[model samples]
Target: MEIELVNCECCGLKEDCTQDYISEVKAKFDGKWLCGLCSEAVSDEVKRGKKSSFGMDEAVKAHMSFCGKFKSNPAVKVADGMRQMLRRRSGDLSSSSSKKFMRSAST
Candidate 1:
């Protein structure tokens, strides 16, 4: 039941988590702790690499490299964050409009 601060091995993002949760994450990622986003990215990489013989270690390394590039460039990270936010907002607007259009067409 102890809470500890864990730093993600990939992105270096620190998270406050219970000791049990930290142990679980480390166990899953080959004894390295990863934040939620990095873990998901690594999982996606593994799924995408299934046909190319990529293993968990390789996927983690690849994701670490990718995150390292952004970590060195603060401006790039900000720009990327803004871009993602806009893309998500736009997607929400589009989906709502599409639903309205479908309703109108049905009528």
Candidate 2:
């Protein structure tokens, strides 16, 4: 098999990749790999923080919060799943959450 050197779809960073690198998002995201810096940018945005032109934007974070909320409660699902798909397609949903949210969400 030819090894793949896909660029980090989040920000076009590149590296040798395998399936193990996919983020554990809402279980339906499909996109290319993300380098460390771009990944951080996306992560910050997903957490509902201020948008950084040097980093991810606030719009990205709000969209992720919307996805998270929808995933946690099917009855309260807002917007179609298409939003999530679009974000993933654009490689924009890779932001990491703060530990506080992670701890609570995992529980």
Tens-place lDDT digits, model 2, residues 1-107: 34466654433445665555444321223342445544554665655453434324443444445434532432222234766778776664343345557888899
Residue pairs whose backbone atoms clash in candidate 2: 8-13, 8-33, 42-95, 43-95, 43-96, 45-61
Q: How far is candidate 1 from the true structure (C-alpha RMSD, Å)?
A: 6.2
Q: Report the CA-based lDDT of candidate 2 relative to the real structure.
A: 0.46
For each candidate in turn, give its C-alpha RMSD to the true structure in angstroms: 6.2, 19.7
Question: How much lDDT does candidate 1 score?
Answer: 0.86
Question: Against the hidden reference, what TM-scores do the models get?
Answer: 0.68, 0.33
Report how far residue 36 has shifted in candidate 2, in Å.
1.8
Error of 1 at 88 (Å): 11
Residue 60 lDDT in model 1? 93
